[model samples]
Target: MIKIRNPEQILSHGDAASRKLVLEIADLTLARLDSYRRIKSIGRMEGSLLHIGTRSWDLLKKRNVYLFGAGKACNHMAMAVDEILGDYLTEGLAIVKVAEETDAFRKTKVFVGGHPLPNEEGYRASKMMIDLVQKSGPEDLFIVVISGGSSALMSCPIEGISLQDEIDATDVLLKSGAGIYEINAVRRHISAMNGGMLAKRIQDVGAELIGFGISDAVGSPATGNIGTPYAAYKSTPIGPDPTTLDDARATIINRDLGERLPRSIVDYLMNAGPEGETPKSFPHNTYFLLNTLPDSCIYAKQICDEIGIPALIVSSFLEGESRDAGTFFASMAREIQTYGNPIKPPCVLLSSGEVTTLISDNSVIRGHGGPGQEMAASFAIAAAKAPGACLLSVDTEGTDGTTKVAGGITDSSSFQSASNKGISLFRALREHSCFEALDAIGDVVFTGNTGTNLCDLNIVYVPGIDG
Candidate 1:
């Protein structure tokens, strides 16, 4: 069960039952994505046959087995694999967002790094990962694990590309309100391990690679959540590809990354060669998806079942501006409460997908918030229009944007709460400072290290007599 750190303050701000239900769903979603739980149910070792997901590995036949990855959830995934392989586990490395320098991690080298942004720590970890891959033998069986934040956590600057350039480019892309796919397209080019380059390197060494992923984006293969170092989507239409000059030009123009992005990044993308992604053929490679947004929504609905309330899975593939999605959800909840046309009242509307928030402006040096909080704060203002409706949007990974809180929830009472604290919702929204605004009203959600990542999970709930 997920425990909200300030339950009293949280429950005091909104409908207690509604906030409780929201937390229940968040807990269920994380539980489903727990790396240990996932590995236990799907992986097993019997003699030489090691089963994970739908594939079986002939361990006795293989020479050496290696595990490596980068992500927020990589720690737990590494822990689970270590437990499963036991004495059979040859060696492993994982770069995670948080640190716990314990004996368990020593058994499988773990490095802590920055998230949402890459730093020197990430550079060190990524460099080490490159060294590990290069040193491995041809007959090695590489089990690559990937989850949200892997893009940054596994950063390795290509030649001529400084870490600062990559950081500036990433910062702009993130703040420019681009979707995961578009942001990935830009970042993959500068990265040494993304865009199938890692897979190509593993192939060059004659090592066989396999992947286990927990998607944190809208699409599967093309979405960049799948370890490009290990697997490729069989489907050509949405399969992986390197970021092209045309891609960069379009993204920059659309999201205005040029004005804010680093000059080095712009030059690299503009002059990038035609040699983008390598061939998609993977004779010795296989990949498996451990969890997805749609799968988690089913688990959330199960909780709704126990509560005897109608639950609707509105959109699992939601995307675009965080504020747009947030305010739109508020309006939708308002509609459900007032008209009850599409979905009857006394219900929970669930949607799972990542959203983006364009920084109000990078010119000023002030605190900004993540998409989840932007949506929730926007709802707090919009909630005044819909008295009975509330919205809770959170990143399932237990961090929203760069804030300490997981996310935020708001209802009709949110306006009063804000007024009581003398906080201006309009100003917060304009400044893109939902983290601070939500903090003022005691509505920020908390569940440290949710042990999973499948994008953002949103709940639009309206309480009625039935609920």
Candidate 2:
């Protein structure tokens, strides 16, 4: 499901040990695919009982079965679910940023949409999804698949807020250094289908809704946005998610998005419409986590352990500025060499989280690279001090933001490679065009849609102490 482009160049161009670590990280990232993990997580339908991640529904008695959702990888997740539901699935609808997979979905209609911001395509897709949900009856069982990018792919702006208004707001947030939680809070309030509003609509009509969430929002215990359609805000989120109002307030007070964004966005946040998103409780339905980024990292760690290498999980829920976070990760490698603390060298540092790139510079196309590339370029420059160090950063979903490439991998000598070519790494970083710079130096990682959206995967290899 995951393919690394220019593998020979990427693996052999850097420190061999870091290449192996990259191989391991890439291998494990593919290992956690929905096709593979779903078997272990979702039980098959046996006559009447259909088990899905600790929850079972009596499908034999149910009449209408509808499926609907939106996300980056919901297409693959929906396909996996379709295989299990088989003949029972009546009709389905889903909106996805990428059409990664198309199997096990003969009955489901997939709509291609946009991400990081909503577009007219997503606007139309969301209306179709709403219609599918609204038509569901008491006898119907709706299986909802929610993953990252759902907030945009499945958006239908509330009254007085146009689709363009929502799109402008999202663009501002993406560049405002706002995390997924903050972004989603504003999203849930502005969207006609978020913050459990969809669930409330279903519950009012007495239909059943069950969800499977493929988390991409810092899955250190899977915090922040629960992909929204899992009846978000049913209980206070385990992740540090602000309420719809609080998030708007925080964005204005903390990030100053009020002045940076369009006036329509500011006015909406300031004065909520009467048809505000105050979703009633959805107490019965449960959201199941099929797998997470931590699970992927741990699986990779197990492989390293079996191969007689010491490894450490730095943090599964890392967040902050992409460039800064990359430097801090390189620092961990430096510490292993200097102090011999935190599991020493000849070790692998594993972490998974979503970092933000606040693209304030307008000299270049802000969509040139994702957070992973920003972090990877920064790490390459910082780890120049530790020749024994190397790292790889990738968005598990494959494409990061607007780029076709997943992310990048770089060793300590990567900076030298760029310098030798007269490519100023910092200049590319400043322009938010790391993709162009990394591509020139052969450090870009290309995994064309792994058919999953967990989060970002970061692995730093320090190969001085032991093997």
Candidate 3:
């Protein structure tokens, strides 16, 4: 009966309960991180490693192994693999956005690149990764480790597209309030290694290739779940013709491009080939593990229930626009408080999922913040609309985008403090500066790099006991 410390009190007393829930969520989030690390610890490579139930270990034994890992969690995942594989790792490479010098991979080469947007360094690193895999022979093994930010960290533009175009397009899709699937659809079309193109490249290569991924998407370990070449191909549809530049633009106005994907992307769908042509099946030996999201939600729910608060474990696959999702959750809080139908009073609604926000055009000059902060701000506005509800939204990874705070919390005092400071809550939301507003009122949650990412966790509590 592991319990979260006084969730009801945390909701009532802004100072104490706010801090407690923040720390509690951070602790639970770390548990998931530990689970991810444990997988690598137990799945270590000895002189030879065998698949779950295979007679042969030769596929992984005494081979020249090359590694390529990308994303915010990529560096950490790479570090774990390096520790487990050791001498068996003949050579390795990694690309990350925030550059941190580390001796984590003793024998592997490490490189830091930009994220959320690709830069020249990211391009160079991506090419190097492909070259490493290309060099592998039948006696070699290629291991690709991918995580959340890999799409940006491993960008290699398609022909006729410049890095700037890709960046601009990415900025548009992100700010367009599109979902992850839609955004990645456009990205797969423009990227060299995305949408299964990367897998196709090594399909005929003599060496065996295996992908180990950390899913930031709704489902776990599916094709394109981590932006691997296989996923890119499977998820996106290939159109009859490569969409011309003009055609792509026309589609934007005609369709809600944010909701619908581009024709070229659909055309290139790996599953779509010649008419009546059977698709090539993935290798029988390939393994895609389901290790994401669920553990964190279950643990968070346990803590809430133990604290004597009725807990509703909502969908682990929550997705879509950040602000809209915030509004929806805030509405749920209002219903629980006023109607007492969802779980009566004295209850916590817990949820985990990735939320996306559109980067504003003004970001060029004013710079917008991350999705977690936007969620916190939007939740506050919605909560303000309903007087007695308290809500907390945070990225489990501690750092939310470029900000140091994990996320923000909101209650009655949050609105009152805005009034006292002569600040308009609406203004803060418009500016995408929720962290600043929450900070002024002493409500921002900071956990300092919990060393893992499992999307976001949100908790809402309604006070008082209801019949």
Tens digits of lDDT, candidate 3, 225-247: 22122332122111011223333
Give the CA lDDT, 0 to 100, for residue 34 in model 3: 47
**Candidate 3 lDDT (Cα, 0 to 1):** 0.60
lDDT of 1 by residue, 65-91 (tens): 878877877877788777777777688
lDDT over C-alpha atoms for residue 330 of model 1: 75
Model 2 misplacement above 4 A: 1-6, 33-36, 101-104, 219-242, 273-275, 364-367, 465-467
- Shift in Å, residue 138, candidate 3: 1.2
Write one digit per residue (lDDT tens) for candidate 2, span 342-383. Answer: 877778888888888877755566338888998999999999
- The estimated TM-scores of all candidates read 0.90, 0.90, 0.79
Instruction: Give each model's whole-structure lDDT.
Output: 0.73, 0.74, 0.60
Candidate 3 local lDDT, residue 343 = 76
- Superior by lDDT: candidate 2 or candidate 3: 2
Instruction: Please list the residue runs of candidate 1 whose C-alpha ends up more than 4 Å from where it truly belongs after superposition.
Output: 3-6, 100-106, 220-245, 276-279, 465-467
Give the per-residue Cα lDDT of candidate 2 at 223.
34
